[model samples]
Target: AAGVIQSPRHLIKEKRETATLKCYPIPRHDTVYWYQQGPGQDPQFLISFYEKMQSDKGSIPDRFSAQQFSDYHSELNMSSLELGDSALYFCASSVGGGGETQYFGPGTRLLVL
Candidate 1:
């Protein structure tokens, strides 16, 4: 399997702006997950999608959202981003279920000014 892939590698945004990041998971994978890892902090779960439907969501604000395509690719959208949103956003994937080990991508580092 090819695992997961994310783009931009890095991003810089001013407060109240919007940012869109992308992710593509290995073929045949049924689940895609998103997470946020801020400086000096562990990765925080953002959301998960299975079969193109959201299966779970974490404590992220409304400014954060995601979508899954038929090909198992996904995108994370942040609206009116704030300084607090600056972090490394990681996209991961696994077969559907909660106990499996997720494979992650290199991540897109977002720097909100």
Candidate 2:
């Protein structure tokens, strides 16, 4: 089984800038998971997209948004990024419409300057 793939493995942004992080889930996986890990912090669940619809959300800031495309790939759109937004953004994929034994992609290390 192939692992998840994330683009632009590293990112740097200025305060109030916008960034888009993309995720390519494993083929045939219907569930996508998004997580954020700040410096020295445990990964926090951000959101989930199932069947191209937003299925769940957790602690996602107002300035952050996400979506899943028809192709099953997902993207996180962040606007007005704050310094606190500097974190590693990870995405995972599972077989069904929820988290369970997911395969994680190497995160996008975002640094909000």
Candidate 3:
């Protein structure tokens, strides 16, 4: 399976501006996850959506929002992006079941100025 896909491989946003990223999960997968990877730091989980509901928030701000549609595609919207928001955003997907493995996308690199 292709697993997942994300758009805008890279982006640059001004301080306090808004940005949107997209993600597409493979068919038959019901869970979609998002993560943020900072320079020289481990990837931190942002949120997870299963059955159209948010499952968890690992380490994300209220300004960072996400949605999963009926088609299983998801989008992450960052409002008032700051310089500290500059990082790599990754999308992943897994079956909502035991031992499910999350397969990640290429990631969107955002450089907030």
Candidate 4:
């Protein structure tokens, strides 16, 4: 199957701007993998939604939120963005559940100016 797909692979926004990132999981996958990698840090597990419900919580800030739709895709909505929000946002999909094996997509690079 094809890998997860994230839109607008590269995004440039100013501080306080809002951005919506769409993630299309692999066909029939039931989980949305949301993680972020900052300037020199390892990938951090932000959160995940399984079967349209939040599966686990992480360090996601109040300004950021996410959702999984009936169709199995998800969206990471970032509002009141800050310069520190700049990072590579990644999405992945798994067949069974949140703890199952995951196939990651080419990440979305967000730059806040």
Candidate 5:
């Protein structure tokens, strides 16, 4: 049983820098989502892609962007790093359409100094 995989389990950055996080969804899963969780805060949906197309957008900042690939993996691009941006970035995957049950990855912990 495979699950979503995210690279660079942890990251460190300075304010004003940029970082790119990678995600590999479960096989056959067509939907990939990105979420950001600040300390003691609930996970916030950032963006999602279905079948390689942008499907939904949430509180993602203008300085951030994401995309799903042909293989169903996804990437989150973050820029203008700020201390407030430090958090756990999670990647979740689901099969079929939106509303389907999703499974999340371990998450990438980003720290801005």
Candidate 6:
């Protein structure tokens, strides 16, 4: 019953700072995705990787980037943070191509002050 794992469950940052969030997907899963949820908003897809290659892109901002590793873990990098950037960031993993059931990790709550 292993699921996705995310680090630094919560983060506090000042304007213009940077933050990196990490995600470890379940074993054997090959597709990873990132999502961001702002206050009173639904989770929006940022990007996704399949088999270590960039597979899709969504609403991710220019100030952000992401990648997946050989072990299938992924990292989302955000920079020049702004107050509006505060939100819940989480990652999900699926078995193969997208459309499969994805398992999500506990979100990382980010706050900008």
Q: Model 6, stretches more than 4 Å misplaced?
A: none
Residues 1-113 of candidate 5 have per-residue lDDT tens digits of: 98889998999999999999999998899999999999999999999999999999999999998888899899999999889999999999999766469999999999999
Number of clashing residue pairs in every model? 0, 0, 0, 0, 0, 0
Off by over 4 Å in 3: 97-99
Candidate 5 ranges with C-alpha deviation above 4 Å: none
Q: TM-scores, in order shown?
A: 0.94, 0.97, 0.94, 0.95, 0.97, 0.97
* Clash pairs detected, candidate 1: none
Report the Cα lDDT for residue 113, model 3.
94
lDDT of 1 by residue, 1-113 (tens): 47688998999999999999999987777899999999999999999999899999997789788999989899999999889999999999988756288999999999999
Model 2, residue 79: distance off in Å is 0.2
| lDDT tens digits by residue: candidate 4, 1-113 | 57899997999999999999989998888998899999899989888998999998899999999999989889999999999999999998897663568889899999999
Off by over 4 Å in 1: none
- Model 4: how far residue 49 lies from native, Å: 0.6
Q: Ten residues in a row with the worst lDDT in model 2?
A: 94-103
Q: What is the C-alpha RMSD of each candidate to the true structure, in Å?
A: 1.2, 0.9, 1.2, 1.0, 0.8, 0.8
The deviation in Å at residue 21 for candidate 3 is 0.7
- lDDT per residue, candidate 2, 8-102, as tens digits? 89999999999999999999998899999999999999999999999999999989899999999999999999999999999999988855788
Q: What TM-score would you give candidate 6 relative to the actual structure?
A: 0.97
Best-fitting candidate, measured by TM-score?
5
So what's the TM-score on candidate 2? 0.97
Model 3 residue pairs with clashes: none
lDDT of 6 at 105: 97
